[model samples]
Target: MIGTLLTFLAVGIVSIVVVWIVLSVVGSLLGLTMTIATFLLFKVAPVMFLGWAALKLWAWARNNRGFLSAKDRRWLERE
Candidate 1:
């Protein structure tokens, strides 16, 4: 009876350890996925905003006459 109880206890400990390891692995994977998703968003958002701004400026230039004053044109030309 004592031997049987010891065996059961060992098995239960092993089972708990296995469950803990699996949960740890899953948690690490979820953390890594979120990190990659956030990194991609940070990297792409600025480029997207800049592209949008450029498109808007191009459209405005095409539709408007003398959008910039002469001083602004001179400043732009100097740059």
Candidate 2:
């Protein structure tokens, strides 16, 4: 769990940095400035979706592998 969270955090940070750099260049060329509020409003939704997708993928993997832990199995059942 800790590792998964850390991995996501690292990926999210890197993704934000890359997106910011690209957007900054494009914005400059277009004479536009992105505000922080707009940035967060747009950016956070996708990051959140990514987290949700990761959970779904993890469940899929566990199901397909047929080695899910009892806790995970119960979690899936609850879902």
Candidate 3:
């Protein structure tokens, strides 16, 4: 009877420790994921948006060239 009780207690303690370790690992992974997401939002997103805007501006300028006269081009160059 005593041996059975001791075995049950040991198993219960081991299961608790295992659960605690698993939770700690999961929390660390969640923190790392949040950090990477924050970096992408703050650092990478602005540069990507700026590149997109620059491409659009360049396309508009290229399309605008067909309507301008030579005199307008000269005036623009002088300015």
Model 2 stretches with alpha carbons more than 4 Å out: 32-79
- Model 2: per-residue Cα lDDT over 10-67, one tens digit each: 9999999999999999988665445655677799878988999999999899779879
In order of appearance, the predictions have TM-scores of: 0.60, 0.37, 0.77
Question: What is candidate 3's lDDT per residue for 23-71, written digit by digit as tens?
Answer: 9999999999999999999999999999999999998997787777788
Best by TM-score: 3
Estimate the overall C-alpha local distance difference test score of candidate 1: 0.92
Clashing pairs in 2: none
> Which candidate has the highest lDDT of all?
3
Local distance difference test scores for all models: 0.92, 0.87, 0.96
Q: Between candidates 1 and 3, which one is better according to lDDT?
A: 3
Residue 55, model 2: Cα distance from true site in angstroms: 72
